[model samples]
Target chain A: MLQTDSLKFSYPKGQTFGFPNIGCKAEETLLILGNSGTGKTTFLNLIALLLRPSSGELIINNTQTASLSEKQITEFRAQNIGIVFQKPYFVNALNVSENLLLANYLGNNALDKGKAAELANSLGFEHLLSKKVQELSGGEQQRVCIARALMNTPKVILADEPTSALDDENCEKVADLLEKQSKIIGAALIVVTHDHRLKSRFNNQITL
Target chain B: MLIKIVWKNIWAKKLNSFLCILLMMFGISIISLLINIGNQMQDKFSKNISGIDMVVGAKGSPLQLILSGVYQIDAPTGNIPMSELQSLQTNPLVKQVLPLSMGDNYQGFRIVGTTYPYLKHFEADYAVGVVFKNNMEVVLGATVARKLNLKLNESFASSHGFEKEGEAHGDKKYKVVGILKSNNSVIDNLILCDLKSIWEIHEHEEEHANETPEKHTEHANEATEEDFDITCALVKFRSPMGLMTIPRLINQNTKMQAALPAIEINRLFELMGIGIDAFKALALAIMLISGISVFVTLYNALKERKYEMALMLSMGGKRTKLFFILMFEGLFLSLSGYILGVLLSRIGLWIASRMLDQNFNFDLQQSMLQKEEIYLLIAALLVGIFAAVIPSLGIYRINISKTLAND
Candidate 1:
């Protein structure tokens, strides 16, 4: 579960962002929509604990993240939260399967190759395990990004513009996959996007 | 797993990695080869000149006299009659006089006619058979015996001079009576015989003199001793008194000239040291540039992989962990280059050894590991770390949220 109350952040005299309080439980999906230049990325970063809130109560799995030390914050974030980037980037030297296992390795969790393969199988890219990341198509690469985020089985999964580059067909498939996987792992899923297509699919929604 | 990443990342930039390794290898091999050749030549030079104090020969270049008389590598400076060196040979300060006559050669190995004391000078022991008890009996040096495959009781006639085209002294043959152990000196390449054999061989050039071979005691006569000619006499003094006055006395009062072996060889080494020192400096410069290239390769890689760094950072990979992984790349490259360079140097040494063996009767011992080689390896590793340290620090500055958001 993840909860945030009156989260506020400022970028060194550049801009201040005052966000709404949010509460999402296990087996839940929250869709936050915002227009361009509306601090969508900043909000995602604040929730990722990459940037410490100026003032807020941000909690994940019932632990207060605002009070955690820098080292503790990194460890806590890695163990409890997973984020899918707006655009996918990978360790180009690694193959598709190793990219997935990287998350577990970086999280200080035991590498589970079986879990990676199972994720690939469910996401319809099992045969592409040995293939290089650059060899995959746009849709395939996006699915891989999704699969990687679930490697450590975090309690909170954050998706940033997950379907911004996909067509009508891949956009729905990736959304359904994310929702289904989060339900299986019993995690609160948060996806921030400007796409109208996903606005209707998600009933629990907020706008920035 | 971390090591694999380091290795893979290095290979990912193929041209950069290849260039880096090639530079370091060239630098290392050049230094290694210089060290091997320098050590071997110095050891051989000092070993050959150890006990000898002076070389007295007919008038010529002192360097040539030392080269021919002590190292047996050059032509002797004309022949001196044995009578001229008689006074110096009997002086109170004179310990021993080794009369070396180099005229005849079997195949290409010089037949140095000297006494048994010459072998004692070099500590050359008999490997097989006994010392020659009669004239015209010869003891082959270890390398000469092994290379020419001459065995005990085999007889071979000498050629007139060192060249294969030199006329043969086919009238009489010298029997191989013994072979000496290898002492890694000039003697290892020579064939030793009694001085009487040289005189008899030269005197009988016109008269069919093998028929008068029973006159072996001719050396005992004063007339024959006065008439005999020797290329040079290697002299050892009992004290420093002889070195000061004997060479000056011989050069001024007599027709023969005296040269100190130590001074001549030392002059030669100092001249050659200039070229060697320059080559070593060039090699070191190349090594420094190679280290810089490694730095550039890693730095560019870090710049290009900013996104990947941020992604891994966001996944909770410690900056220090990523830093160590990248640092290992430089270490691996340096170490691999060092291994290859040493192997190349050995190959070069082997080729040189073969050439020296053929031309100068010299062999370089190859199996010995040089202390400089070990030190260079450690230097290579330090260079590796020094090169990687700056670029790997870029890991800590990556802003995971900003980088990922911008991407």
Candidate 2:
């Protein structure tokens, strides 16, 4: 579970981002919708613990995330969070398997090669695991990124415009993969997107 | 995983990586070549004069005596009185005295006249014919024999000076009595003969006949007499006695000056030492600059990859892990550059040594990669780290919320 009580964040001196209070529960699919200047991405970042809230208590899994030291915050994030990005940035030189291996390494977890392979195969990435990240198509790269995100079996999945670049068919495919994977792992699935077509797929929605 | 990422990143910009490595290789090769040649030159020059304790010559330049007597590459200073040489030979401190006379050249090499003692002093066991015995008999250095293609018993006339075309000692042909083995010394460029042969050829030269014809005639006809003059005398002490006493006696009592081969060579190295140090400093600077380039490039890449970094951060990659990831990239680049540089340098040295031997007849032996090269490699790696430190800070600054929001 993630809780942000009276969360206030701004880019600089006068630019405000997150609202004063926002929270999302575990195992729920969140649809955060907002106009360009509102703090939709900022709220997701705050919830992900990547940025310090200007003022408030931000908690995840019963721990006050905002109160944790930088090192502790890093450890907490590694153990509890997963992220998928819109453009699907990857370490281009590495093959899909190697990229996933790094996620496990950064998480301070022993590589469960069998589990990683299983995840890849179930997500239809089995043959693509040996290919370099740059060689994969956009949809394939996004799936690999998703596989990377779930490698450590974290409790929260925060996706930022995860399907923005994909075609309608591929977008649904990616959303299906994210929703199914999050449910199987028993983690919160927070999907941020401008596309209203995904509203029906999520069980929960947060309007900014 | 860190290594894999770094490698992929590098391969992504293959041309840039290749360019950087090529530049490093070029720098390394030049340094290696210069260092190796300098080493070989010092080795060959020192070996050329190894056995001679002191070089006694006419009262003029000591360097000239060393160049002509020990190396046989320059004009003799002048001849000394035979009586003076005889008196020095009679000294109880004198172990062996090999008199040298120079003034002629076969092809472009100096023809040196000395006794069998000179060959023994250099440990020159003839590779092909017997040692010099009769008048006008010449022993060829390994290089000289190979170059002119003159085998044993083949006769070649001597030139007056080092030039190929000059006043020739055409009247007195010197038969090649022996050919020496490759010694990697100045001796490899010389033609050796009896001291009397040099005296005999120059005794009646046109230039000498114009000024000192009577003096030449006096020495030529008075061969039966105990009077003679040699260009220089190579002296080895019987014990430490000559080392302590002979130089002092020669400097004070005689007109000739005795030069210690080791001391003069040491002085020469001291003079050249500054240049070598300067070259080393330049090499250090290049390595430092290359390291900085690596750091700056990676750091810049990190800034551009901020969103990606934040994505990783939110994916549960720790700040410390991210930090190490950047640092390891730098380490990988520097180490690869250094290794490549070393290989290039070694090859360059081999090529340079070959060229030197071919052109100068100065044999430069191929040496192993030196220990200092390792230090250079370490320096490069450290520089790489220094460059990466500032940029890796991006990982800590990446705002996961903003990055994910913007995405």
Candidate 3:
């Protein structure tokens, strides 16, 4: 489970943001819909522990993250948080399988090649595991990104604008994959995007 | 995994990495070559001049005396009366003395009229036949024998001067009776003959000149056994008293000047050190520039890969791990360059030794690694780490949210 309470953040230039309290249980999906400059990515970054909230309480798997040290937060984030970003960014130098293994490496876990292959098979990109990221098509790259995020089986999966650049078919397929993968891992799935097509796909919704 | 990532990153920027490696290789090769050549040459020079305490020759440049009498690399200043050297040899403070009679060459190898003691001093042994036992018989040094392709019983006419192409001593030829083993010393380049042969050759030249009345000088009739002369005499002292009194006594009382090999060699090194030091500074400057290029390459790469860095950071990679990835790139480039540089320097030394052997009969093929080179490697690593750390510090400043959100 992932929960946030009255999350607030401010940039050095004096722009402050106050977000509504949000909560999601394991195997649930939350859709955050917002237009440009809605601080949707900032909210995801805070829950990812990438950006420390100025004033907030972030609880993931029943552990409060606000008071954790920097190192502890980084470790905790690596072990329990999975992020799928927009545009399907993978390390250009690594093959598809190595990209997934990188997630395990960063999470301080022994590389599970079997888990990577299984995820690749489930995501329908097992044949593309040895190929470079640039060799993959748009849909294949999205599927690899989903597999990479699910590598550590984190308690919360956050995605930023994951379907904004895809076609209607690929976007729905990606949304379904993200939900299906998170449900299989029993993790809370949170997606932030400006795409209005995802609003009906998710029952729990927030608009900014 | 980190190493693999670093390798891939370097391969991805192949051109930039190659440029850095080339620059480093150039700098390191220059420094290593300088050190190797300088060390080998100094070692050879010191080894060749070790036993002789003082060189007594005609009053002239002391450096020329040491270079000619001990190292046999320079022309003799002039000849001193053999009677004068004989008296010095008998002095109580003098343990031994070896007279050197130069002024003739057989195919560019100097013919030194010295005794068995000189050969023993260098620990030379005959590789073929036996040592010269007669006035016309000769024993060739290893290099001379090999280069001239001379064998026992082969005869070659001596040239009148130090140069290879000088006027020939037409009436007489010296037969090679022996060839010396390679001893890696000055003796390896000499043509050894009896002192009587040098005197006989000069006497015959004087007699021939006397036949032409117009060219005859008063000294034509002065050639005799008692009045014979030698170019220089190498002196070794029996004790410290000889070192204190012998050279000064010779300088003050005799027409000949005494040159201490140690002092003259030191002066020669001091003069040559200026050039070596300048070259060393030039090598160091090139290394510094290479280091700066590494810094620029990595710094630009970090700037260009800001988004990638942010993505790695968001994947829960520590900033320090990303920093090390860049550091490893720099270390890998410098280490490869250093290894190649060392090998190239050894190749350079081998080529130099071959050329020197062909021309000067000096061997410089000692390809052993020096302690200074280990220090150089450490310095290179420090330079690599320092150059990399400056730019990789940007990892700490990367705002993952801003970078990811903006991209």
TM-score of chain A in every predicted structure: 0.98, 0.95, 0.98
Which regions of candidate 3 are displaced past 4 Å? Answer: A10-16, A54-56, A66-68, A112-141, B125-131, B140-181, B202-224, B238-255
Name the candidate, 2 or 3, with the larger lDDT value.
3
**Candidate 2 lDDT score at position B347:** 71
lDDT of 1 by residue, B1-407 (tens): 67767876887888999998998999899999999999889999999999999999999999999999999989889999888878987899999999999988998999988888998899988999887778899999999999999999999999998876699998889999999998788888999999888877877773454435444344335355766789999999999999989999999998999999999998999999999999999998888888999999999999899999988889888888999988998888888888888999999999999998788777898956798888989988888889988999889888888888884
TM-score of 2: 0.76
Per-residue lDDT tens digits for candidate 3, residues A1-208, read 8889999999899999999999999999999888878888788888888888999798999998888999898889889999898868777878899999999998899999999999998888999999989899888898898899999999999988888888999999999899999999999999998888898888799986
Better of 1 and 3 by DockQ: 1
DockQ of 3: 0.63
Candidate 3 true-interface contact recovery = 0.60
Worst 10 residues of 2 chain B by lDDT: B217-226
lDDT for each of the candidates?
Answer: 0.90, 0.77, 0.88
lDDT of 3 by residue, B40-63 (tens): 889889999888899999999999
Error of 2 at B305 (Å): 2.6
The DockQ scores of all candidates, in the order shown, are 0.78, 0.48, 0.63
Error of 2 at B108 (Å): 4.5
